[model samples]
Structure formats: structure tokens, C-alpha cells
Target: MSEQPKPLPLVISPPRRREKPPRHLADLTLEERQERAAELGLPAFRAKQVSAHYFERLTDDAEQMTDLPAGQRVEIVQGFLPGLMTSLRTMQADRGTTVKTLWKLFDGALVESVLMRYTDRATICISSQAGCAMACPFCATGQGGLQRNMSTAEIVHQVVVGARAMARGEVAGGPGRLSNVVFMGMGEPLANYKAVIGAVRRLTDPAPHGLGLSARHVTVSTVGLVPRIKQLADEGIPVTLALSLHAPDDELRNELVPINTHFSVAETVDAAKEYFDKTGRRVSIEYAMMRDINDQAWRADLLADVLNERGRGWVHVNLIPLNPTPGSKWTASDPADEREFVRRLEAKGISTTVRDTRGDEIDAACGQLAATES
Candidate 1:
């Protein structure tokens, strides 16, 4: 008799022997930076100086760091800010308000970030991993499988570069501050929890120690990493949590998000609610509106019931227009269907909003450009 096929594992552990990224200052805390400087035979004060130039002044170029002594400037910058990534390609859309950059990491892994400028704020959606292991069939990054978990510095550098562009007015609109960061670019952020949390700390830490962005402005999205969601709630940081719950029922979600098979819909939603209860930060439920797949009007009502079952005013649904990949079967839901889905959710008192789909011309869907390059 043929044995039944074994079920797939929930987490795809990173393959062995992947080369680690170069160590950078952003990977270290302020005190650790001082200790490293001492080991380099440089005074402790130099650490703060270089951090000021990089974090406060938004420059990583050693030449621009005139405050450091000429002899030690190169050593300090090289010791701490060794080049991490270089732009392989950049595309602009939305009348230049949205700039997407494809960055080649030191190990030749490619990841992308999109800097979006709005009337009131500038937000950069950054990648947490070079590729994803979540294996969401509709996602480009997940199809590519796991490359390697990104180093803490690699993740944070994306934001710093975007911030620099905004400060210099390189990304359309006048010089402005980067007010928000979203971990919705390429990978399941919580799967790389330690590094993601470190990056978050660096982002919210004060200038000279970090970028100093407010914790409230940071949002980390995961594909229902239930245990990690609970762990994040315990952490004092109150960054918003976004659960990419494409379907509200186990039958559909198991196929849509394979991880759901291990952690069922009820378990995932419960953890998300616990996060909200602990942090007092409302959770955002991400639903990709797929044509004839998970976007039916009934699923909207079911999703509303799923959330309302937990409690009132604890979650909001952000509907994403499915950005179909090249030659893929998945596509965005029809306008009428999308509108009706929204109406259904709102009718049940679930605050909902359709995500502003941008940069289709620039291959803005996560990992599309990188997949093309590969």
C-alpha cells in the first residue's frame, strides 16, 4: 500500500552554509559600538561621532564625516559602516512620488524597498529577508523560497538609505523626514524575529544611537506566525502588528497560507487579539483580494464574524488588490466584488480600507523585480 504523503513543515529553516553579511555599526547597540571602538584602538567618543553622521546627518560616506580626524575617519567608517548594499536598479512611479529600489547585498542576494511619499508623510516599506520561506503561492517572494535570513544591519540599512533619499529630496517632493517604516516588503518578518526586533530598536532609539523614529510609526507584518505574535506582545515595544490573514477559515487559509495548517485560523486570530490586548495597539488584518479565490462576499462576512467573535474595536481590515504575477493564475478581484466585500465588512462594523495599489509599472509587488533579475 502507498503511504500517505507527509505534510509539509510549517517553517522552512534557512539552509546551511549561507554566507553571513558583513558586520555593520547599525547591528550593534550604542554601548557595543563603544566597546568595538575601544578594541579598534580608537577612543570611545569616535563611535558617537560616526553614528551622528550616519543616523542624525543621514550620510554614510566617510568623506562627509568631516568631524572625525582625517587619519581615523577612514578606519572608523570602514570598521563600522563597511559598505552593505549597492543599488542595482531603481524605478520611479506615481509621478515620482513612489521610488522602488532593487539593492544587491554584499553576498549578492537581491532585496527591494519602496519609498512612498504622501502629502503628510513619507513611508518606506522595507524587506526583512532577502527571500521568503512562508510559501504563499500568490506571493513572488515566497515562490522564490528561502534565500537567507537578513542580518539586522541589512534590514535597517534599507530604511536608512530611504531616509537619506528623503532628506536629500532624491525621492520626489521636497526634503522631508521618513515618518513610517513597514515590514511588508519581501519576507515573513516574525520568522526572523530576533533581527527584526533589533532593527526595530535601532529605528526607535534616539539619534546617534539610532534613527529615532517613533515606535508607533513602525509596523511589522507576518503571515500568522502565532507564537511570535504572542512573543511580540510581551515585548515593551508597541509597534503595530499586521497579520496577513488572507482567508478567515481553516479550509481556505490552509491552502492560501500553508502555515495556517500548523496554526489554525482560530489560534492565529487569538494570538493577534492577545497582541492587541497586551499592547493596546490595534491590529491590522491584511487580506489580498484574489479574483474568484478568497474574495467572495461570504468570506467578507465570515472574516467580520471571526474578528467580531473576539471583541469589538480591536482590529481593522486592510484589503490588498492582488498584484498578479507574470503568467500567474491569481489576479485582482473585480471592482464590483471588491466594493461589495468592503460593504459587507463595514456593514458588520469592521473598519476597513483598500490599500492604495501603486507602482505596478515598476514591478512594485514584492520580489517581482528581484525574480526578474534572477
Candidate 2:
């Protein structure tokens, strides 16, 4: 008999690092920042001042920090706010309400983030890593494979940048606050667990210490990293967990999201339920509907059954219409099929909603622009 092909090794952690990104104030806790300032022979209050400028005032320029002595301003800013990532290119759609930016990290690794402004709230979807390790076949980020994991500050900077844009009225809307953050950009957030958690803390901590966003307003996505999901439940942070369970059955999910081979659909769902039980935060089931693949009416029934069997009211099904990559075989599901799929789930008493698709013209699918640049 012909031998079955060897399975590829899963990248649960990033490969060895080449060089680490420089430290920034956002990466440090308040105490650590104060200690660093003392080591630099500056007053500890300088640390809080710099934090205010970055997190509160949304300015990194030393010149804008008039409170500090002119001689010390440059040193203080350089010590805390070394440049991290720069916008390589930016594209906008939805009348400039949806802006997508491709960022070049210090080492030239590329990532992308999307800022979406709506009537009630402004949201920024930030990347946790330059590329992804979860080789989910349908996702642009997963197609490119993994680069080095990003530092805590690198992830937080994306939000600060987006928040700055909103605060300055750079987006189509009038000046507003960035109220939401989703770790659904270019990487598997859980795979970079430590940095992702640090970023979450930095974002939700009170002003001068961090961005002060409510933990409820943050969502972190993972492709069934079961252990990480469990660890997150015990972290005391109530950020919503989004499990990208693209298929209901193991046989299909193993192919769609490669991580399923390590953690089965049953195991993944169980972890998600435990998360909801512990945190009282409803887990979001993210399923991208691909035409004729995982989008059939029967699969919808199976999905509802899978979720319902876990117990009700602990999950919400978010149906995303697949954003097909250029020349990719997968395309968005037919409207009729999508409607039927939703009908089946709703009929089964599963709370379901179709996602508002945005940023198609600007390659808003996480890693598409970075992939294109490469």
C-alpha cells in the first residue's frame, strides 16, 4: 500500500527570533516605567508624563511635551517612545469610514490593521503578529505562514495610532473616540499568547497606565488553541473570546483550520464553553461562509447542533461571507445559500447574525496587502 503523506509540523509558538523589537512605555507596567526613568537619571514622574502623552494626549512628539525641560524632552521621548512601525500604505473604502493600513515593522516584517468607523462606535482591528502560523486555508494571513511574534507594545501601538486618527478627525467621521478593538488582523492571537495578553492589559488599564478601554470592548480570535483558551479563562480579564470554528465536523474542520487536527472540534467547543462558564462572556463562533464548502444547509444544521449540544446562550454564531482572494477558488456563498444556512441555525434556536462585509476593494482580508507587498 502506498504510504500516507507525512503531516506538516504545527507552529504553536513562533520560530526562533532574529531580533526583538525595541522596548516602549506601553510594554512596561507603571512601576516598571518609573524604575526605567530612575535608571536614566530622570525623575520618576517623567514616566507618567510620557505615558500621558502617548495614551492620553496621543502624541509621540517630544516637542509637544512642553512640560518637560527642553534638554530632557528628547531623552525622555527617545527612552520611551522609540519608533516601532510605520505605515507603508493606506487604503480606504466605505467613504473613508473603513481605512486599512499596511504597516512595516522595524525589521521590515509586514502586518495590516483596519480602522472601521460607525455611527455609534469606532473600532480598530489590530494585528498581533506580522504573519500567521495557523494555516487556515481560507484566510489570507494563514496563507502566508508565520513570521516572528510581535512585542506587546507593537500590538498596542496599532490601537494608539487608530485612536489618534479618530481623535484628530482624520477619518470620515467628526472627532470621536476609538471604542472597540478586535485582535482579528494578520495573526492567530492565542499563538502569541504572552504578548497578546500584555497588549490586552495595556489597552484596558486606566489612563496614564494604559489606554483605559473597557475589557468588554475587546475581542481576541484564535483558531482553536485549546490550552490558550483555557488559560485565558483564568486570567481575570473578561475580553470576549472568538473561536474561528469554520466547520462543525472534525473531518472538514481539520482541512479548513489545520489546528483542528491537534484539537478536535469537540475539544475546542468544550474549551469555549468552559470559557463562557468561567468568564460569563459569550464566546463568538466565527464561521466564514465559502460557496459550496462548509456553507451547505446541512452543515448549518450540524453547526447549530454542535453549538446547541454545548448548551444554549453561551455562544453567538457570526457568519462571515468569505472574502475571496484574487484567483482563489473559494468565493462568497450564494445569497440564497447563506440565507438558508442562517435560517437553519436560527430555527435551531442558535443566535446567528450575518457579518457586515467591508473593505473588499482595499484587500481588507487581514494579510492580503502584506502578502501582496511580499
Candidate 3:
């Protein structure tokens, strides 16, 4: 009895907050908008007009908001719709079909968002956190450590800008609305749960209040935050859930995804299964193929086996070619190995596909460009 030790205390990491999120259009509720409009001494109707211009029309340019009186346009724009970010520089590849824009936040925090133009549909990849708290050795963003959790408005602003660019036919493949959004940018989205979820709501909510994007077209990715995964399931959102399962076994995942120490691979999959069960949307397993690191054919078979053990009709695998970060020893798997990895997964009845790389020429590896500037 004397030798028995006390149980380890449960330590919950507080969500990091460096600076307050600026009061902007995307961060406010419809009622809050009215309140802010009143505070600015503008009629409540002006709030609706501003919402239409910002959320639906996708233009924050005061001059462009002509519905508001000429003198009040700038005031309305400056009041509730104060822009949260400015594009620093934009780079392109694939004949300008892949565009990556680095954005400067009000607090001087840098984040990136990429818009990919395909003939069928356009997709935008946006950052949820400024840097990242998860110290995944293979990721460039993790190398710098977490700067701050991006506000819901900060996350939504990136899409609004992309939507505006698409509307003006700036991106290639002609003018089109953004058909998809992926939370696969600078940080672990689930780590900033509230802001990420709030952004999703604002993206999916109907017009004049939100971007009106389809919930199904949005994908929220996490590096296996088990509890958060379960929490997201209960949020009643129908969006797809993508788990960044870089490795199939705990032993390897513990190294590739540092957070795996808290939530093992099996636990991660179980949580994903819960998501699928709740939403009726299949879980996407994002596997970044590191050359000879986790790219072995045997590992692929093990990955397939693990997914198969969870049963079928609930999970799909997206095998990504690792985009080499500067000076990093990790690199993409050989083409032949990537093919074999896919073949092995499919052979075992697990649905899999090699993800198409975008913005490679521009070094669109999330925080890679910003890290250089710093």
C-alpha cells in the first residue's frame, strides 16, 4: 500500500492566444453586426447592405459598395467590414493554374492560402493557425512552432479573397466559384477547434451572413486529435473529416506525428469511424509518402490491413507525395514506390488514390516561403 503511486494528473493544454482577433465581418453574429452598425451610428439597414457586399458579393472595396450612399460607403466598409488581411505576394505554377498567396494578418502574423484551378472545379487550401503547435518533424510549419490560432474571420477572409479572385477571373480555368476548401495549410486545425469550427459554420451558412459554400465541399483535417475528432462529430456539421495518418502503426506514427503519443493510431481510426458513423461521410486518411521512411510496400500492406480491420465503406486514403521542405532530410517517395503503395492498398480492398500535387514549383509547402522571409 505504501509503494502504490498516485495516478498521473490530466493536463489539458490551454488553446494558445497571442493577440485578440480583430472585429471583422466574418467573426460577428448577425445580431452583433446590427449592434456594431448601431455603435458606428449607422442605420441597422446599412449592416444588411454591408453584409451583402462582403459575404455575397465578395468585395470589401468601399467604392465598389455602391448600394450604400457615396459618402457612407467608405464608412460602412471601414466600420464592420474592416479587412483582416492583405496579400503580401502571390506565386504561381502550372501555367498560373496553381496560385499560392501569402497573407499578412493585422498583427503582422503571416499565413498562406492556395487556390488551385482545375478544369472541373476550383479548390482553395487555407490555413487555420498561423504556424503550428504540433511538432511533426516532416512538416515545415512545425519547424517554427506555433505563432497563434487564427481567428474565424482570418480563416474566412482568405476564402473571400479567393472567391473574389475567382469571380473576377483572376485564377486560370476561366471565372468560377471556389468549389472546395481544404483546411490543410500551416497548422493543426483541430488544435484551434473553436475558430476552425466557427469558420466552417460561416462558410456554410446561407447568404448575407456567410459565404454560402456547401458543407460537403469543405474538408477539415486534423493530425489525430482523438477527443477533438469526437467533439467535431457532435457539432452536427456534415463536412468531410480528413485525418492526417502519415503512418499506420503507433511505433512509426509516434515519430512522424508527435501527437500520436497521446492518441495512438488505433484510437485515431476509431475516432474517425465515429465521425463517419455520425455524418455518413467517409473519412479521408491523408498519408504523406516519405521516401523509404514510411513508403515501404510492407507499411502500405499494414496500412490497408489496419483500415480493413475497421471494416469497409467508411474510409478512403489519399496518399500524398511529400513536398520536400528546404534543408530537410525527408523527401518524396520514388514514383515506383508510390505506385506500389497504392496498388497494395487497393489490392487489400482499401480505396486509395495518389493525391495530385499543386503549387510545387512555387514551393507552396505551407510555411516554407514565410520561413524564408523571416
Candidate 4:
């Protein structure tokens, strides 16, 4: 018998130092920006001027900042608003209306953001963490484990880049403003609670501080992090909260969302109810329809019952067809099962809709390409 080939030796590379310039406006709040500008020997008002260019004008090139002193424009831009996203690759589908970009960060870390342009609006999906800690068996990013929580600025910069790209008509179709933002990429938003909230503020604050998008236009999804859910409700922002409840029961949820081990289904539902009570904004329950796992008719009925008992008219169910990662046993539910799931929820007087799947061709379902590349 031929001898088996020797296994290839594993080679480990030292972490690459973060390259590119360091100034990132997304990392600072309005006051902090002013403070930094003052320390840099620029007037505090310069910070607001820079912020207007970034948030309102959606332009970063100092040359276009005609309002600033000609000589100081370059220094202000370079010292405070350095480039954060370097587009490494872009893949488009849905007739170019949906585009996914793989960006190489200053640290050489690969993260992705998707810009989906529709008839009336454009939405950008941003990342909260570099990888993920949830470790859901069916998820691509989770399998990679958590690298680190992205700074508030890093998270907001993703949106600004997408917004700028859209406004400049760099994406397919003509230029348009980004209307919505979703934290549905790469990492769990609630896991990086403080930074995610800070990013939200930066996105919603008016010009000279943030992108000026309405709070209602932002959606933050979590895998039922109970404490964070309560904390988010208290933040006084009315951004929609989406709970990624893959399974309705404790047993299956424990297997699918590992955090369910700490907070049971009952506790999670109660927390969801508390959020609604506090914010008066309808909570969105996101269920990914996995074939043969959480797609059974009984689970659907149970999901309806739980929502009905917890609170009525204060919750919406968003059914997502599973976007299977390569080599994963989990797959999307059949059409028949998906229809039945919706029917059961509607029967309970709960509002329901299937999420429009976009950018599938670009591995848009978070961390799939990054994991494969890594």
C-alpha cells in the first residue's frame, strides 16, 4: 500500500499592524470632536464644520469643503476624518440594486457591508463586531468566534461609507440618500452594546454631529440578550429592536442560540414585552426558518401562542428564509412550510411578513465569505 501523504505543516502569521491613517470621525461624539479639534490647535467650530461635511454633505474630500479656510481644510480632514473603509471587492445581484462590499479595515481585518437600493429607499447593513461570539451552529460569523467589538466609530463609518457611495451614484442606479440602517452583519449588536448605541446616536443625531437619519429608520437585532434588551429600551431612542429568536422552545433555542441557556424562552419573551411597554414601539421577532428544525407547524403555533399571551398589537413577526452557509447541514424551509408558519401567526392576529432576501449572490448573509477566505 502506498504510504499516506504527510499532513501539511501549519503556519501561523503574526497579527498585522493596523495600516492607513488613524483619524476616524465616526469614533468621536460631537463634544469629543470639538475637544479633539481644540487640542489640535483648531477652533472648536472647525469640528462642527467637518461634521457637516461628513454627515450632511456626505463628502470627505477637503477640497470640496469651500466653507473652511482654504489652507486648513486639508489639515482638518487629514487630522480628524481619515479613510476607514477600503473597498477590496464588490459583488452585485438583484439587477445591481443590491450590492455587497468586502472592505479591508486599517488593521487589515476584513468586514463587509451591504447596500440595498429599492424603489423608494436605500438601506445599509452595518457590522457591530469584527466576528461574533454567539457561535450559533447555523451561522457563518458565529463559527469564526469573536475577534473584538468594533468601536462606535468603526460601526458608524460603515454606514457613512455606504451612504457616501449611494449619494455619489457609485452604486448601481443614480445617486440617492441612504434611508435605513440595520445592524445585521458580522456580529451581534447587543454584544457591543455601548458602541452600538453610540453608533446609533451618531447615525440619528442632526447634521454637524451625525448622519441625521431618524431613529425609527434604524434597526438593531440581537439574539435575545435579556439585559441588553431592557437597557436598550431605557436608552430613550425608539429604534426598532429585532430579536433573533430562531426557535420558540427552550430545547431548540438552547441549541440554536447558545445565549438561550442563560435566559429561557419565557424570560426572553417577557423581556420583549417589557421593551414594548417601555418604548411603545412594536418589537420585531425575527425567526429564521430552518428546514426540519424550527419549521415544524407545531412550533409555529407555539410561537403564535407565546406572542399572543405576552402582548398583542405590540409585536411583529419577521420570517427569514435561512441563508445556508457552505457545508452547513441547516437549510431554508420549504415553501409550503414557510407559508404555513405565516398562516399560523396571522391566525393569532399577529402581523407577519417574509423578509426580502437581497444580495444572496454576494454571500450577503454575514461572514460567509470572510470565513471562507480566512
Q: lDDT per residue, candidate 2, 1-374, as tens digits?
A: 12322344655666764888998998999999999898889889999999999999999999999998998889889999999999999999999999999999999999999999988999999999878877777788888888889999999999999999999999997899999999999888998999999999999999989999999999999988899999999999999999999999987887888778788899999999999999999999999999988898999999999989989999999999999988788799999999999999999999999999999999998888998999
lDDT of 4 by residue, 10-97 (tens): 2211224434336577778778898889878999888888888888888889999999999888888987887776878888899888
Stretches of candidate 4 off by over 4 Å are 1-23
What TM-score would every model get versus the actual structure? 0.98, 0.97, 0.95, 0.92
Better candidate number, 2 or 3, judged by lDDT: 2
Global lDDT of each model? 0.92, 0.92, 0.87, 0.85
Model 1 off-target regions past 4 Å?
1-6
The residue ranges of model 2 lying beyond 4 angstroms of the native Cα positions read 1-11
lDDT-wise, the better of 2 and 4 is 2
Clashes of each: 0, 0, 0, 2
> Would you give me the overall lDDT of model 3?
0.87
Cα-lDDT of candidate 2: 0.92
Query: Candidate 4 at residue 192, lDDT?
Result: 83
